[model samples]
Target: MVLQILFIAIALAGVALFSYNLKKVIRNIRIGKAANRTDQPQKRMMTMVKVALGQTKMFFRPIPAFLHLIVYAGFVIINIEVLEIMIDGIFGTHRVFGGMGALYNFLIASFEILALGVWLGCAIFLIRRNIIKLKRFSGVEMKGWPKSDANYILITEILLMTAFLVMNAADAKLQAMGAAHYTTVGSFPVSQFLMNLLPNTEGALIAIERGCWWFHIVGIFGFLNYLPYSKHFHIMFAFPNTYFSNLEPKGEFSNMQSVTNEVKAMLDPSFTPPEAEAGKFGAKDVNDLTWVNLMNAYTCTECGRCTSVCPANITGKLLSPRKIMMDTRDRLEEVGKNIDKTGNGFDDGKSLIDSYISREEIWACTSCNACTQACPINIDPLAIITELRRYAVMEESQAPASINAMLGNIENNGAPWKYSPADRLNWAKES
Candidate 1:
């Protein structure tokens, strides 16, 4: 009874703490302006199914994708055993599902196999990131905590899997010794080989089994809480983010509604423009961006796929799409913290522009959508970049000399060149 009470308390506390943190994340996401992603609900559902559930885009790189698929499958399948653990924990029963007989055996055996796959997959990933030092894993944005976070996650998985296997091995040994409360259940194809290493004494076996049981559950709880602060939070946010993906043509830029309204008012004598919204041109901070844009920032996995395929980054420019997402998330978190410290109206005098992201980085993008195409989860860093550029041009009236000259030509000549429409054909007029 005491053990069951302790287990229940720990589980409840872990869940409560996680809920509080997640509420803060949702509130932060809601700080941004509204967007119309509810249109085409069927298409959005299918998008989530294809990308987040099917993981079709991960196959662009076969090796890592296969490894990731193994880990993903393993993590999901093995967690089914956690259900049994919870039931047993709550009732102080030993292997409550063991009464299912052959079915239980099959489930346990399959879990062991998958646990092994997760173990090996995580090991290889760690080697690739640390020993091999893959180019995608090394960058200005990946330096401090991002690099360490990946390593920590892999190491933690390996430890959890080890604990799980060791616990099974100890339990099997205890059952063979006819120990009290040690039921003869489960077929351990993988942990069976590990039995010889354990002791013959029943007390020692029980201690080992129970210790590992506690460790595995506690580690899972810790990992659950750690996810929100880590890049791995994509495991949860990826579905909604992919569902709300922009389904428009990649090359098409969304015209600012404010600008369109102003233009219409100028052209028509009696046209009444709608009242300005937030009275801001483009996004100067997180509050100015759409909610989906903010969600995209939070969903970024920092896998560097977007940055790796980015033309600007490839051509030695400072515009890393991964960095742009990271900057937005970091700045948004900063704003959230400021609001928590002071009231809702608090301002730290910092904005997303100039403070986190630079004008040069924003201007370096070719708007080719290569980054968006390469992302496995469809995170659109290009959207954030475009907003930053818009704020610079319309609000600050600040742009590079070349861009200013181009805008001048567009306004006067109706094109992005010095020549007029009449002279557009002069070059091809056999001159």
Candidate 2:
């Protein structure tokens, strides 16, 4: 009774810690300027179901896709077993659903199969990242912490799954011996082999079972806490990110509303443009960006798929869409920490444009939607890149000489070339 009470207290404390961190993330996201994404509710629901839940975008690359599916499905579906673990932990019971005989056996068998899949999938991913040397997995962006993080997640998952299997094996052995607290609950089709590796001593067997059980649950709590600080936060945020994806055509770029409103008043005589909103011409920092852009930052997987397909990156230009996302996330984290420390507003004076993402990288973009399409989580790194460019051009008038010449031509002659509009008919006659 005392042990169960202590376990329940630990479980509640773990949950509390997770909730507090999650709220911090939510608060950080809300720091961005508001834009309404509340439109198209039904379509949003279907999109979340199709893209995030189904992981349809991942299937574009077959081998990695299938392997990812194994680990992802295992992580999600096998977690149903966690419910039983929780109930048993809290109530001092052993496999509370054990009474549902055949169904329970089938569920356990399925979990074991998926656990095996997760183990295999992690192993292959480790090989692809470390040994086989996938090009996308290395590079400046993935050099130190990013590379280590991927390996850490994969290895931790392997160990967690192993602990689960070991726990089941030891439990099954105890059941065969008609032990007291370790009930005859689960089917160990995969774990039965592990039983032979365990000791013949009953006390030693009990220790192994308890050790594995406690480790599995404790590891899960640790992983849960780690998500807020890791790219793995996407495991929770991916659904909402996909659901709120830009519903417009991918080729379209979102205009800066402040600039657009200015142009609207100039063109439409009857248009009563609302009083000019006060903000930077475009995003100079993370807070200047829309909440959606910030959300994209938080959700980035750092998978480098955006960089892999980038025309600018391929052609040796400075732009890397993956780096843009990382920069945004890094800047956001910096700002978040600053806020926490100083309790002051985001007036640290350091901006993402100059400090983190350089003008060369932002200007190198062809504005191609390749990066947008390549991101599995629907992250729009190109949008952030464009935002920075917009800030440079509109606020600082720092457009290149060639672009300035084109703009001058447009202003004088209503065309890209420096010819009067009245002379436009001369071209047809000459032709």
Q: Candidate 2 local accuracy as lDDT?
A: 0.87
**Using alpha carbons, what is the TM-score of model 2?**
0.96
Q: Write the per-residue lDDT of candidate 1 for residues 50-157, one digit (tens) a residue.
A: 999899999999999999999998888888999989898999999999999999999999999999999999999999999999999988999989999999999999
Error of 1 at 163 (Å): 0.9
Which residue pairs come into collision in candidate 2?
none
Best by lDDT: 1
User: Which parts of model 1 are misplaced by more than 4 Å?
Assistant: none
* Candidate 1 CA-lDDT value: 0.91
Q: Superposing all C-alpha atoms, what RMSD in Å does each candidate have to the true structure? A: 1.2, 1.6
